[model samples]
Structures are given as structure tokens and as C-alpha cells.
Target: MAEQADHADRADRAGHADRAGHADHPAYPVGLRLHGRRVVVVGGGQVAQRRLPQLIATGAVITLISPSATPSVEAMADAGEIRWEHRRYQDGDLADTWYALIASSDTTANDAASAEAERTRTWCVRADDAEAATAWTPATGRSENVTVAVLTTTSQGRDPRHSAAIRDAIVEGLRDGTLAAPHHRTRAPGVALVGGGPGDPDLITVRGRRLLAEADVVIADRLGPRDLLDELPPHVEVIDAAKIPYGRFMAQEAINQALIEHAKAGKSVVRLKGGDPFVFGRGMEEAQALAAEGIPCTVVPGISSTISVPGAAGIPVTHRGVAHEFTVVSGHVAPEDPRSLVDWEAVARMRGTLVLLMAVDKIGAIAAALIAHGKDPATPVALVQEGTTAAQRRVDATLADVGERAVAEDVRPPAVIVIGDVVAVGPHSAPTTGQDRPGDQQ
Candidate 1:
């Protein structure tokens, strides 16, 4: 029995060793390249159109074959940007091509092209069927001296949509100075968790904006606002974490891991996020992760949308006599879960105001919950969309009607909802009749 026990222990140790070995494997292979190559694209629709510009920028000699072409492609062909066959792909279309793209709408043509390219020992990209290709286009990106390629291969190729998204993120990161080359003069790496401010780029703190200008690598989410990115230098490095409205995202764990990995590689990393990183931006989590890794990091706060958004819409949470205080809550959290740790009853009864972030989607339910918890149904509320920007708009109503009004007005995300009597003090409020009564009339 003792011999058997020893054997089991040995097996367990071997298993753990094998697992560790697997875990040490890299997430992806590196150093893929496709510069100044001859390539062919088999279609001319929107997808083909999308790939053309990127291919041209990579200095690839692209030959497009299609029965019909989009106006953009035709214009490019006219301008000598690319060669267009203006005919359906022939059997020998893949011949003499270093790389071929099978983007034809017909599946049979795509298959034939793939087979032909394989026979010629040339690389083929099956635009739609990535798995069948000899090589797949990853989300190819270049920021300063940093090049990024994201690929998902399940013993196969990749998904085109996912690849495109990854590429776009990289481009954004680059343009925003989020992806920059490290200072070769210094090997020490530092990190900055910068708040991107509210919707307006002007609201970004001076320090935060300066850091953005100096960023060697920037990793930001969709909410970081486009105007801020527009301010980045041309050679900056930028990366997108794939956080889009109502879309799947790169897990926060993965994002944190990426940030640390890049910083440890001796690159100045900037984790740019919307609004103040401490105001429910999950900046704390990222900071903790960096601390545990012993990486130097600093937090630069921005104007939190929690207060600025409401204020931008001309609604004050606290007034001299109207409201003595205010409460801020995350609409992104569950109202029913106790661990959400929100004191709904206290907030409802407090002689103050309430401001909600990321609660637009659950407005109706939240309003109902608040009323049920003893908050007045008649409390004035204002939904401010794209606050502090040229696109700013507000929908005002009572707590009981604000959600419905928001929907009716088509108020979208990136909005803040303010609930309190202060909303009634805005310029749009009913004018006092006393002042206009007699001699004031023109």
C-alpha cells in the first residue's frame, strides 16, 4: 500500500510539471511580417475595399480580381493605387503570386483559389474562411517602433472581424500616443493610469494630457473619447482593449496582465481610461496589480463624469438651500444584490441629491426601486447625453417619467442621470412671473 501511495504521488508531481510547462508557453508566436510583397485579392465588395487601404499602406503590390468593384476600388485602380483585373478570377489567378487573397463572394471560387495557391507553394489568405488559408492576417499594427499582431488560431487560421477590430485598436493606440517607442536612453519603465476626463477633451487634466503626449504605449477602452485620441502625436503607440457598447470585451484580467507585461519589458505604459480612474473606473484594480508586480505607477485623476456630467447639463447636485448633500451610485451595478454595497434606502431618505453613472440601461428599474425605497416619485431628474461636448443634450422629467422620456428622446449611452430638486433650477425651468409683470415688458 505504501508503494502504491508513493507511485500516486509521483504521478501527481509529473502531472503538475506537465501543466506548468504548458502554462509557460507563449500566448502567440511573434515576428510575423508582410512588407513589399506581391498579393492578390479576389473580391471587390466592402470587405475587399476595407483590406485594400491597409495592404497599400504595408507597401504590398495588390492585384484585385472581381467581376464588379466598388467605386472606391475602381477609383484606386484609376489612380494606379492597385491593379484591377476587372474580370472573374481565372484558374491560374494564384500563379506567380507570393500571396493570394480569396475574397470572392462565391465559395467555389474561393476554394479553387486556395487550392491553386497551395499547389504553387504560395501563401493564400481565404478572406472569409481564415482556417483554410496558409496564413492569416492578424490585427496588424505599428506604433512608432512597436508592431502588434493579434491572432487566434485553433489549429487553424483566424476570424476576419476579430482581426480587423484588433487592427483598428492598434491604430487608435498608435495615433493617440498610447503605443510609443521606449526611451532607449533609460531602461527603467514607469506606468501612468490617466483619467481621460469626461466626453470633452479639454476637461483632461494638464498632467494627464502631458502624459498622453509622452506615452510610449497607450492601452485605452472605447469610452476614452475620440477627441482625446486626435490630440496624440503621429508616431505614438495605441492599443484598444476592445471595450465597446453592448459588445463582448477583453476580460479585465487579461488587460491587467497585458499592461504589466508591457511595462516589465522596459516600456513606459499608459493605461488611459475615461473619467477619473478612481471614480468607478477600475483604476484601483489595475494599480493594485502593478504594485504587486513591484512596477512603478502613478494615478492621474480626471474630471469625473459623476459630477461634471450633471453640472454640464446645468444641474447642481448640492445647492445652498435646495440640496445639502449628494450621493453618487454606479448604474452598472445590480440594485438588488446586497454586495453591490449601495445603501439605496439611505440614499432614498437622505436630504440630498443622487447622481447615477452607467445606469441609463436600467433607468426604469432603478427609478422604480428608488420610489419603492421611499424616494419621492415627483423628484425632478435630467438625463444628460454626451455631456460637456458639442453633442451635449438633456432630457428633463420627474423620476417617474425620466426613463420613459429618455427612451422617447432616444438619449444614448455615455450619459449621466441626475435626480433631485436642483434639476428644476435650470434656465429652461418655468420663468418667474413677478419679474416680467409690468414695466419690464419691451
Candidate 2:
């Protein structure tokens, strides 16, 4: 009997070697049009739960055969997404089936069903044994109009994690404009006001990145994720709306005219700015300008730095019991500036948190006004400079001495100032020199 068992083990190894040696007969990749066609899944366990959603999406006529199933699979049956036979697999289960997946826990049932699929010349996948299966599933992903599928034809080289990693890489490249397929897509002529998010290229919205990938012309600001510009195709034109070659920034009127002219000339235009286009970004001005010229405009919201910046430095604008409300105010102009629209006195009187953007230069006067109006001079303040970028740092101070700290610490513009007790609630509330903080990656 031991000799017979040794012989069987040798035969099994020989079978595996035979399959591995037939490299020329590798699986030929083809996408099945399973819509309205019969498909059978012989298991309702974890495998079925994971693979059913993609099958149902194909609009195929699916029938699942199993005595029991996971709750999620049962839910799919209850929702009429699939027909569940609540019985053990029978010999004729694969009859008239276009494709079959044999994944039942019972080895005997799986073998029978796989044999039926083979006898009927139907393509089948055996989860228990890939070598015995006639077909294999590829790691798939969709980016816009593109569908990516990665497969390893050789059984010896098969690795699901490797295939999934390749799929993710390709999809991410397609979404981020690194892999531009301009020849395959028809470009539409219009203006898209896309907020590029704080300073990180990855922070940009997927929609914003997709629009950028399809753009014929991009009018970019200096503040946002400028690194993305280096990824644009050579045929695409990038206009520096923030600065010109002559040491002067382009005027708002000129920028508006640029958008209108490019769009009218039958080019896809993207006005990529930092932060949300609607939050003090003059996005409405651009939208109104486009409307006046009858140009179509699409606004894509972005992650605003007003909240994200402080959060990156471990500050929450609103903490339970610390502050119930937070107000975002632009500090481009000093509190005493004639053109300033913010009522500093009224703002100081509010008991909630105060978040000031573009306020590094004017924080001193602003702090003094807040103190005089009724805010506590000793209220904790945090200045996050170049927030969410490689150069990000935090400066801790109070309303009474933030002005001096700003100058002494060489704090620059593009800093977010946070005031109120919420500043003291964060873990990074401890005092630190103006240097790169932890987790301040690009």
C-alpha cells in the first residue's frame, strides 16, 4: 500500500510538470460579452461574494448553485441580481451554460460540475485547481473610457497580488495624466475651473486630473500643485497665469480673455487654481466672465487648504467642547484696510474658532484688533506655513505676541493662522521652533 501511495505522488508531480512544460499553450486573453448570456457560479462562499458584483455588472443571466451562502450573496439573490438554487450541485448544473465557475467547497461536486462543463465544451474556471481550469480571470480596472486588464499566462508565474499591483499602477497613471491617450479621445471645447487642492499633486481631485489629462490648454496658478505641470504632454500648452517672463503677473482681465479666446478657438481650457475655486478664489469672477461670453464652464470643487492645512499640523478647527463653530476669513488686507470687507471687531467678539488665510503679513494688526474687540490676548495661536507641503512648519504663539513671533520666526505669506482654544486641543499644541514638523511630507 505504501508503494502504491508513492507511485500516486510521483504521478501527481509528473502531471504538474507536464502542465508547466506546455508554455506554448498559454491562456489566450479575450474579454467575454456575457450580457444576456447564461452563466453559472457553483459556490456562494467568500469567492462568490467577491466575484459576483463584477459578473452582475455585465448584465449576464447568472444562476448560483449552493445549499447555503454568505449573507451578502444571499442579499444579492434576494435583490433579484442572481438566481440561487439552494441545493447541492447536480450533474446537469452546467447544461446550456455559456461559462461556469466551479468553486464549491465539496471537492466531489466541483469535480462533477467541472467535468460537465468540459464535456459540453463550455469555458470553466476551477477555483480549487487553476491547472485544471480552462480559463482565468484577470485583474481589471476602469479609468474613464479605458479598461485595464492584467494576466499572467504561465501557471508557474501566476501571482494575483502582482497582477493587481500592475492594474492599479496603470489606472493611476491614466488618471493622473502620466499616461496620456490623446489620440483615442475626442477633446471637447470648454473651460473647466478645477481646484488643484493644497500643494500636493496627489491631493487633486480625480475629476480635476482627468480634465487636465484631456486639456489642450491649461492656465495654471503658482500656488497649487505645480509639479503636475511637468507631467503634461509636449503638445499641450501651459500658460503661466500667475507670472509672465517679464517679471509681472498676468492681470485678471488678461486671464479671463485667455480662457475665452482659447475656448472660442475650439480648445479645451483648464483654469487650475489652488484650493476650492469658490472659496475666495475669484472662481465666480471667472465663471461670470465665461457666462458673459456664452462660454460653457464646469466647476470642480477641491480640498481647500483652509481646513486641510491646519489639520495636517494636527489642529482641528472645531473640537468637541473646545469650539463649536469655526469661521474662515481672508486676511489679505489688514484689519484697518479701507478695502477690507471683514468686520474685525464683530469677528473678534465671536466665541468660536477663527481661521485666517493669506494672513501671515497682517496677523499682527489682526491679532491686536481681535484682542481689543473682546478676545483673550492669551488665546493660543498656531501659524502653519506652506501647509501640507515639504516646507510645512508650525509656529506657536498667542494673540498678544504673534506679531513679534511672526517677524522673529521669519514667517512668510501663504500661512494659515488659527486662533481660539481649539489650537490647544491638538496633539501638536506644544511649542516648537519654526521648522519642518513630523508627517509634513510632500
Candidate 3:
């Protein structure tokens, strides 16, 4: 009887603590399915601009009532992404609203909107006041298909910066796969052509990474993410695509046959190529071959090396008021080659950024062709080798001396050459090596 009394006293103490924790701060967290639901957003300022994207992504039927909106919000309205009413908020605006957000600058307008939502028993969030708001906004994050939201409340009020920081930390863990693995597993009897994004392992898309994790056999290109291949389990087979030589028309045919043969045997084949597979990776041809054999296949787009490599070296392909246009060109063959179809002379006359891939061998003749066609000899140039990787290096030179300098520096293939005034505007353009100008000899 004494032991039973002691147990009852302990249970009573536990119940009191639980009640104390919930006192005046009980928040019921629930994931609302807002798709195809009616949502009314008031104001067109910065706060509304920030919240509108999440609503659009959720496929919410948004009725925006505002006198004026930010440039981004205006663009969305013009594009017909949302229904924008160019007027002030009315009391009847919340009549059918399932959710409401008041972010207007005027406190009077915000108060009026909130009162209407209360009358309708709709959840309302006020950007200007946390204490007065019936609903609090949470910091939102996403990784793969997973969503994470966090809200931090302090003794004084709510702290958004703290919440966002926590959200960012959680997102980083999700991205690196330390916190969770991929949800969808790629099954066999098909092939996936994935763009690995330049030479960086982390740049690949979330879907590409998930599919690759389930690969039974990965046919990898020389430019593909080699680091990712190393991460594969021991059971996975790694095939070097470069080892398979193509002398003539049979080369592509051989690749097609390889994919078809492996997939037919019930293996999940991943054709990992550098940058975007469709750009210059010949991905469509492989897909065609698979389709001819009636094989299941899908293509995942990747960041193209043509643009990404230049950006990695701090060279913007297009700069406002500097270069309004950019063009990607292949220089695997010399300009003088009869088989080359690009009009080199016409390209030289255009004032835009020129990105050259596989051009290290023919750069001298190409530069000469451009210069001969009235391109400036002193046009700034940058060669980004092995871009977006540990072995990356940038060599800055002028159109007049790029070929000679590249040879002198021993710059090799798998490099992107950027030409035009945009090159001079990059961080590497400043002569750190004290050669002619900044970033030269880097």
C-alpha cells in the first residue's frame, strides 16, 4: 500500500509538469494541403513578394488585392502566374478565403484585413505583428522532395533570423545525405542519361543523385563527376567510356548497343556525362537507340560546362551594359577545316561573350581568324581549366597572345575559353601575376 501511494505521487507530479509546459504556448503544428485551395494575399510590398512564391509553388488559387506590387510581383501578374486585383483590400475579400496574409505598410489597412479574416474564422498571418497574428509564419526549406519548416519564439517576441539560420543548417545536412538518404529508388530494366554538372560532384541535380545511388552499372565519361563514381558501392560496375574508341560511324552505334545490352539484362545503367547531356554529350542519340529497342529511358538535365565553367572562374557570360549576348561555340576542329559550319568571320564582328569548348588545340588559328575578321587584338580572354573542381586554374590573356600564352602555360583540354569585355570584368582580370594586367599568368 505504501509503494502504490509513492507511484501515484510521481504520476501526479509528471502531469503537473506537462501542463506547465503547455501553458499559454500551445502551438498545434499541421501540414495543410493548400493545393487548389483559395488564398487571399493583401499588400504588394517586400513581405508579400517574399510569400507569394511559396503560394504559387503550392498551386494555391491566390487572389492578390493590392494597389501596387514589387517588380517581381508585377512580373508574375503580367505572366498570368496569379490573379492580381489592382485595387485596395475590401472587407468582403476574405469571404471565401481559406488562408489570408496581410503584409501592407499601413497599419490601418492591415488591421481591417485581419478583422475580416477573424469574422470568417480564417487563419491570418500579419507580417508587421507577431503578437497580434492568429498564425505565425515559419521559415521554409526544401531538399530533394522533403520539406523542413522552423519557428523560433523568444521571450520578447519571434526571431526570423534565428529561425532561418536553423533552417539553413538543416537543409545543408539534407543535401549532403548525412541526415537522410534518397526516398525514391531507381529500378532496373532501363537507362538514365544524367548530366553531372561540369566536374563537381555536388552540382548534380537531386533527382540525378537519387537515381545514381541506385545504379547497378555506371558508364562514366572522362568529364563526368569522378568523385561520385568513387562513392558508389563495391557491387556497382564502373566503365570508362573513353576506353571504348570510335573510329567512324560505328562509335555511337557501339555505345547504343552497350546501353541496350546491359538494360535488356535487367541492369539499371547510368550514362554519366560532364555538364548537360543534351548540350554536346550526344545523349539524345543514345536515347534514340534505346527507344528503337523499346527500352525504358529518361534524361536528367545538368548545368552545361559552357556556361558553368566560365561562371566558376568569375566570368559572367552576360553583363548588363557590357555584353548583352553570349554565344557557345565548339572548337574541336580548326576554323579553316571545311567540315566546320560555324561562320567564324560573322561571329568575330558581334560584341558579345564568346565561350569556346574543346578549343585549346585550335585557339591560335581561331583567334587569328577572329582578328583577321576585324576583332580587336587586345580583347580580354580567360581560359578556365578543369572548372568547378580542385584542379581548376584560370589563365588570363588577350586575343592577340592567348594561343602563345596557353601553350607556354601548358593549358590543356576540358577547359572553357571566355572572350569579350566580360572576361576583363571578372575577378581574374586584375593582374595578380603582374603580367600585362591583373589575373594574367594566373
Candidate 4:
């Protein structure tokens, strides 16, 4: 008992000395070269959860020593990204570890791991006590290829929250282009399918914009943000995707071939489409085609117009106490047409928002069919022309008068026809023209 007491006394003193030494010597800011090195993490709680991802990204062979860990940490272990020991930290857990993170809430266990790390000549980080840690983790932000790390040691001592705020601000600036990235294009050679989001240039995602800037060849859709094309450099080859054979399958194949051929010719190609590629845009076909040729493809998803267009015009597809469901259907063909597969009778029975895309031409026939199928003639409708763009216009009508109203108002194609009570809830209330004018010819 006396010998064990003396050893415990020695361990306590050693821990106190280690803490004092850490406090006396401020941490020198440096990024670790942890690539392909063994890193031992002695804890599986919240603190370890935050640190594990950074270590994993560095290509570190992580060995997590803990009886139990957070669900995310457990998931990482399950995914084979990190090796979890699933046991308490033993004396020599850090034997082959090049770096150690002692994040256990149990101070004694943290001390033991830190001591083991120190003895093995490994850098150790302590979450419970930064003063006891030989190394400190910096708040980090990455923008494109640049990683910005902010360490608050003495100058901004013990204020990780402030450091993180600064890091976030830097990241925000990077995303918004307030901080300039090198104009020199640096994306890897491959085909990137970017969703341009409706017809607005600003709605394009940050990654999409960055990739667009790097594109050597851009295959642009007709409905894609046209303003973005004007911004591209003179040297960039821009192909009008709509002009590529009008047959759906043929056009898709041609677009895929263009992407593959461009990439094969050592050009970075971007297939920019309006709305999400998978949402009626047939983006996966392009991706699958690229995959067959072993050509890498990157997809940047965009906001779909089915939701965005209505929402922009102050029409929520799903509203509380009004609509719980919304159905978006292509209106290219008439319900009476043999090629049309839509169940007009069933659609008429549904008491939900009906968003009709590409249906302006056959909308009168569609409305007539809906009413014939037991739909109310007074169901409100809002025809949004070129929604979410400069050419945006809304014409109010009802199922009974929408067809005639459309003819009277000279409503054109490329308009979204919103039907249901949700259309009544639209912010813009343009009174429908009751009288036919001389030049109001459809």
C-alpha cells in the first residue's frame, strides 16, 4: 500500500509539472505533417469528434482508445475511416503514435495518455485542460485550395470562439468573392455538371461559379442563366446545348459525347443546366456516360424551378392549413393526346397544388380537360411568365377563364402555370382583363 501511494504521489506531481511546463512555454503555431502517420485519440466524446475529422483528412491512421464514443465517432470507426480500440486507454496506447489527442472528460485518463504521449516523444492535445496540452488546435477555414488557420495563444489567448468567428468571416469572404481567389483556373481536368438554378445568375452556387470560371468549354442549356455566359472569357468555347439534335435521346447522347470528347482533349468541360440536372434535366445520363468512359464527373446540384419559381412569386407550394402536397407535371402534351400518360381524372380529384411546367400552349385544353374531369371551374390560377427573372410577369385567372384570359393577355410559353388555392395566396394580384382588346391576339 505504501509503495502504491508513493507511485500515485509521483504521478500527480508529474501531471502538475507537465501542466506548468505547458503554460510556461506558449504553443508555436505550426501545421502537423500527419500524413500516413499513426495518431492516437484517447477519448470518443464531443471534443474527439471535432478533432477526428481533421486528422482523417490529413491521411492519419487514427487509433481511437475509448470505452465508448459519440455516435459520429462510432460511425467513422464503422466506416473504416478510423480504427477504434473500443477499450479504455492503457499505459502504452501512444507507443507508435506520432500525435495524440487526449480529449477524455476523465482528467486522470487524459493525464495518463498525455504522459504516455510525452514519454513516446509525440505531440499531445488536451481538451479539458489546454494548459496541460503540449499542442493546441487552431480554428481552421478552407477556401478553394487555401487553408487559413487562426491560433489564439498569447495575443488572443484562450479565446477559441473569437478565433473561430474570424475563421468563418474569412470563409464567408472567400465564398462571396470579397477576398479574391487567384483568377488563374486551377480545377482538375474533368466534366463538371453544374445546375445554374432557374434563369438568375446570382442563384448559381458558389462552387458552380468557381467551376464555371475554370471551364475551358461550357455546354449551356437554353433555360440556363444566360447572363453567366456573357461573363465568360472570350477564349472559352460555349456550345448551345438546345441546338444539339432536338430528339431527347439524341441530344443527351450528343451532350455526353461532347463532355467526354472535351475531357479527352484535355479540356475542363462544364455542362451548365437550368434547375437541378436530375429533376427532368437528365443529368445522370451524362454522368453515367462519363463513368463508362472512365472520365471523372463532378455534379453541383442547383435549386429546381418547380419550387423556386412559385416561391419567388409569393406562392408556397405547400402551405399550412392549405396544402400538404404539391404535384409537378410536364404539360408538353395534351391529356387527349395518345402520347400523354397523365391521369387527368386522378389529377382533377387531388386537392393539392398543381404546378404545370412547359404547359402554356396546351393550358386551355388542359383546363378544359380538368373541368370536364369534375374539377371546379373557379379554382384559382396564376400564370407566372419567365419567373424569377427580369421578364417576370403574373396574370391572374380562374380555371373557367384562364384559357380565355391567357388568350386576351397574350401569355406566352416559358411560363409556369400554378393551379389551386395556393395561386390565390400569390402576392401579386394583377386583375384579369374581362374585355378583349383589338391587338390582344394569341
Candidate 5:
């Protein structure tokens, strides 16, 4: 009898603490089916701009009442996604409205519109005052087909940042298969051309990582974030599709044939390449080849080393008052080679930054051509090798001696060559030995 009495007392104390933690009654959460219903948004500022897309997605007949709106809101109105009254809120705007959002800059107008919503017995959300709002918008995110919504309130009040953090955690977990729910599995058979970003596994995009997590087969390149393959499930077939330059390598035609065969066999295929597939990565060629075979292809863009590698080495491709234009070109062929399509003379005529990829082997001839075509012989140059990876390093030199410097440092392929005054513009312009770490110099 005494133990039962103690349990009852403890339960009463827990209930009391729960009630004391909230300043107002706990809000009951519900998903409103708002399709074909009248929804009015008062104001057209950042708050309204942020909320409009979700409201628009509900298929509600939305009417936006404001004298002025941000450019994005104006675009929505122009696109006919919503009807814009081009006027301020009046008393009767909430009549027959099923739901309303009050986010105008004018507090008096917000108060008036919210009061009208109250009188009409319609639910309304107030961006200015959550205490007075009849409805609260939850922090929402979508992962795969699952929608995660979180609404959290502290002893003080609504903690939106906390709610957002929770939402992000849930969404990331679901996306990467960390949550491991049955409904979140991906079984679709198609090809996804994913850009693995510039050598850093962490730099790969969320979409790319999610696709990798779902892939039954991953055809990987030698240059991209190869570490990502180690994280795949044991059942996933990781094909070594490395295209080594001037060595044992798989031909492009063979790679295309392999992708077709695997996809035709009903396995989900991901052609993971280094950097963006479209940016000189021969991604469009594979895309075209897949199209010929009637295979569905999804291209996910990655961060290209053309810009990111230089950035990783503390060099902005373009700086204010320094360089207005930065040109990126492939330097696999010497400038004098008939097979080369790049107009090296025109490139040298421009007074801007020049970024070269696959040019380590031909740097001597390329630099001589640039100097001969009016480019300054003493123009600064920095080569970032294995950029964004642990082995990344920077080799600095001038255009006149970059060829000699490349030989002295023994710079190899897979290095990005940045040429121009912009290399000398940053705090990291100091020369370094080849052993300098990327984080230390970049």
C-alpha cells in the first residue's frame, strides 16, 4: 500500500513539472489538408518569402495582400502562383479564409489582420508574435519521400533554432540511411552521374552521398573522393573504373559499355567522377551514351577543382580590383599541337587569371607560348596539387620560370595551375616548400 502511494505521488509531480515547463498550454500538432482552400498571406517580406513555397505546394488558392513585396514575392505573383492584391491589409481580408499568415512589417496592420482572423474563427500564424498566433509553423524538411517536422518550445518560449537543428539532424540521418527505416530505402534502377567534388570525401554533396548510399553498383574514378567507396555497404559492387593517364587505364568506350550493361541488368548504377561531371569530366559523353541505351540518367553537379582547388589554396579566381575575368582551359595538349582547340594567343591577350588543368606535363611549352603572346614573363603562378585532400600542397613560381620550377619540384599530373596577379593578392602569397600542407598555405 505504501509503494502504490509513492508511485502516485511521483506521477503527480511529473505531470506538474510538465505543465510548469510550458508558459501556455501545449499546442496540438496537426497536418492541415489545405488543397483548394482559401489561404491569405499578409505582407511580402523575408518571413512571407520563406513561408510561401510550402503554402504554394499545398495547392491552396493563395491571395497575397501587401502594398509592396520583395523581388521573390513579386516573381511568385508574376508566375501566377498567387494572386497579389498590390494593396495593404483591410479589415475584411480574412473573411472566408481557411488559413492565414500575418508577416507584414507594420505591427498595427499585423495586429488588425490577426484580429480579423480571430473574429472569423480562422487559424492564423503571426511571424511577429508567436504568443498571439493561433497556429505555429513547424520546422520542416524532406528526406526521400519522408517529411520530418519538428516543433520545440523551451521554458522561456519557442526555440526556432533548436527546432531547426533537430530537423536537420533528423533529415541528415534519414538521407544517409543512418536512421535505417524500412520506408526510406531506395530501390529504383537508374543511373546517377554524381560529382564527388575536389578529392575531399566530405565535400561531396548531400544528394550525391544519398545516391551513393542507395547504389547497388558504384563505378568510381581514380581522381574523385575514393574514400567514399569504403563507406558503402558490403553488398555494393565497387567497380574500379580508374582512367590512369598514360598507364594501365580503362578506355572511355569501355566505361560507357560497363555502365550500360550494369544498368540493363536492373542494378542501380552511380558513375561517381571527380569534380563536376559536366566540367571537362566527359560527363555529357556518358550521359549521351546512356541516352542511346534508353537508360534514365540523373546528373548531380559537383564542385569543380578549377575554382575550388585554387580557393582551397587561398587564391580567389577573381578578386575585387585585381582580376575581372578568370579563364579555365585544358592544357593536356601543347599550345602548338594541332590537336589543341584552345586559342592560347587570345587567352594571353586578355589581362586576367588563367587556370589550367592537366597541364603539368606541358607547362614548359604552354608558359613559353603565353609569354610569347604578350603575357608578362614575370606573371605569378601557383600550382595546387592533390587539392582539398590530405596530401595537397602548393608550388609557387613566376611564369618565366614555372617550367623550371615544375621540374625542380617534380610536380605531377592532377595539379591545378593558377596563373595571374590574383595569386599574389592574398595573405598566403608567401612562397612555400612542396611539403607545406594545404590547410597551412591554402
Candidate 6:
């Protein structure tokens, strides 16, 4: 038994040694110059078409060899963007090429080309068989004056599918200008998990602005303010991670995985969110995930709907002489189990403020529950929808009447509800167009 144990240990050590050896193999280096370099592309379909433009963009002198080329490739050939060789790849096609790309649908042909490139000591990328290639192109991205290249080597054994998805996300970020220019003095790329400030572009912070200007990739949610994105440079990559309200979305696990992957690729990534990342933004969860992977992350706070919505409508959550304390709650809960985690009775007795987020749909039921739990129905409630934006509207009424008033005012999602004496202190006594109030446009 002891001999068997020794043999098992030896086998494990040998396996580890083999992996280390594979890691040491030279394939492709990051940020390699391809300008004016001879690069041969094999194939003529969409895959090859997709790979060609990026190569051309990098100033690679491209020679495309295929029986037929896609119209886009044909156009590029006509435009003198690339040299189109009207034939299939031959054994010696890569002999004179400095670098080769195999984007053909035939895996067999891709493998053969990769093998040829290797034998000829030429750099080669097998789009269909990335593992068999001498090197692989990462999802390439560029933003304004910034350029980001993500390379996944087979030596690391990272799954190509996950790597490709991550690369696509990075490319999207680069096209969106969310990835800022790299700081020359500091080699370390900074990360900012910015809250997009409750769906209003103007509400984003100055620090957020600075970080956006410097980021190489912006990983933003669907609900994030669109105007903020509009300001980004045209080349900046913007990736939409299936964020939809009351609909299916890209799983949180997928988003977390993408974040870690991009950061690992050494790009300055911004996990842009809809509200304060700490306030139900899941910022802490993402931060923990990043920290676990040994990636540095920093939180850039934003105007959370919890406070901003009420404040925008001239309602202070905490009034010095009136309500001295405040509590924020999530209104998004199962109907049958609405009071599962919260002590409604305790909240009723606290004599403080209650700010409800995502509670518009459940406002009536919540008001009834609070009243049933001994809270006064006469408690003033202020609902501000689309807060701090040009489209903002305010609804002011007692807790007993606020829900009905919200319906009358046509208040929508991204609204904030403040329940306390602070609602009574506001100048406006009824629902009014947000434009009527001073400093409300912000």
C-alpha cells in the first residue's frame, strides 16, 4: 500500500511537471506588431471575413487565399485593402508568409495550415482549431487612443469558448470607449465599478467621468444610462450583457466570469451599473469575485435611487427635527412572502424614514401591509419617477393614497418612494412635472 501511494504521488508530480513544461512553450506575445507584415488568411466565408478586417486594421499586409471570397472581402480586395489569391491553400502557402490565419470552415484544412506555419517558423492562428495553432488572436479591441489585445494561449488550458466570449466582451468594451487609455507612468491598470446613477446620464460622478476617460473596457448593465454611453468615442466597444427588466438575462455567473477574464487579460475594466454599486448593485458580490481571483477592484459610488429619487423630488430621507433615521428596502419580492426578511412591525415602530426601491408595482400591497402592521396610514409618501432626469415626475400623497396617486401620475420604474415626515416638508403638495422645480434637471 505504501509503495502504491508513492507511485501515485510520483504520477501527480509528473503531471504537474508536464503542465509547467507546456506553460513555458513560446507561442505569441501580447501587443505584437503586425504592421506591414506579411499575413496569409485561409478561407473566404464570414469567419475569414471577420478575421480579415481586424488584421487589416492592424496594418497587416494581408494575402487571402480561397476559392471564393465573401462580398466584403472581395470589396476589400477591389479597394486594395488585401491581396486576394484566387485559390485554395497549398502545402507551401505559409512558406513565405510572416504570419498566417486559418479561418476556413474545414477543421482539417485549418490544422494543416497551422502545422505548415509551425514547420516554417511562421506565426499562425487557427480560428477553427485554436489549440492546434502556434498562437491565437485574442478578442482585439480599440477605443479612441486606446488599444486592448487579449491573447489566450493553449498552454494555460483555458477553455477557448469562454476566452472567445470574454474577448468579444472586451472588443465591445473597446468600441464603447469604456476602456480608457492606459496610464503611461503606472503600468498597473485601475478598475472602477461605477454606478451609472439611477438610469440618468447626467447624474454620473466626476470621478466616474475621469475613470471612464481612462478605461480600456466598460462592462455595463442594460439598465445603465444610455446617454453616458453616447458620450463615448465611436471605436469604444460596448457589450450588452442580456440585461432586461422582468425578463431573462445573461446569468450573474456569466457576468462575473467575464469580469475576471477581462481583468486577467490586463485591461482596465469598468463594471458600470444602474445605481450605487453597493446599494443592491451587486457590487460587493462582483468585488468579492474579483478579489478571489487576485484582481484589484475599486468601487465608484453613484446616486442610488434609494436616496436620489426622494431627494430629486425635494424630499429628504432624514430630517433633523422630523425623521432622524432612515431605512431602505427592496420592494422586489414574492407576493405571498412579502415580509419574509423584514420586521414590518419593527419598521412601523421605528418612527424613521422608509425608502423603497423597485416597489412601484407593489406599492399598494406594501402600504396595506405596513398599515396592517400598525404603521399609520397617514404617513406621508413621495414617489419620484425617472428621478434627476428631464423626464422626471413627482407624486406626493399620504401612505394611504400614494399608490393610487402614483397610478394617476403615471409614475414608472426607476422611481423612488420615501415614507416619512420629510415628504411634508417639500414645497410641492401634489404630483407635478419635474421641470417646475429648481435644480431638479440634474
Residue-by-residue lDDT tens digits, candidate 3, 1-442: 9999898778668745654553356456667678999999999889988999998998889888999999999988898878999999888999878899999887898999988876677889998876666677789899766899987653245678888999998877666544545436655479999998998898998767767777788988888888988777788888777532122223666778888999999898999888998987899999989999999998989989998998898888976556768989999888999999899988999998999988997899999999999999999999999999999999999999999999999998789999999887756455322213333221
Candidate lDDT (C-alpha), each: 0.79, 0.88, 0.84, 0.84, 0.89, 0.76
281 Cα displacement, candidate 3 (Å): 1.5
Output the number of the TM-score-best candidate. Answer: 5
Residue 241: error of model 5 in Å? 1.2
Stretches of candidate 5 exceeding 4 Å from the true structure? 1-28, 33-36, 44-46, 57-59, 66-88, 104-112, 152-158, 181-186, 427-442
Q: Quick one: ranking by TM-score, best first?
A: 5, 3, 2, 4, 1, 6
Per-residue lDDT, model 5, residue 111, is: 97
Q: Provide backbone clash counts, one per model.
A: 12, 0, 6, 0, 1, 17
In the predicted model 5, the residue pairs found to clash are 313-442
Error of 1 at 76 (Å): 69
| Poorest 10 consecutive residues by lDDT, candidate 2 | 433-442
lDDT tens per residue, model 4, 80-125:
9999997888897788888898988778888888778766668888
Ranking by lDDT: 5, 2, 4, 3, 1, 6
Q: Taking the tens digit of each residue's C-alpha lDDT, what string does model 6 give over 1-442? A: 9999898888768745654576666455666588988889999899878877778988988889888988998999999999999887878888778888788876777778877876676877777755566566765555435566665654566665676677777655554445444456754654679887877677777567656756667888876777777776666566666466687787888888888887788777888888788887788888999889888998888888787777777887865456667999888762348355776667778788999887888888788888888888999888887787788888788979877987887777877888887788766554334223454332
* lDDT for predicted candidate 6 compared with the true structure: 0.76
**lDDT (Cα, tens digit) per residue for candidate 5, span 250-316:** 8899999999999999899999999999988999999999999999999999999999999999999
- Candidate 1 vs 6: which has more TM-score: 1
TM-scores, all models, native as reference:
0.55, 0.74, 0.75, 0.67, 0.83, 0.53
Ranked by TM-score, the better of candidates 1 and 4 is 4
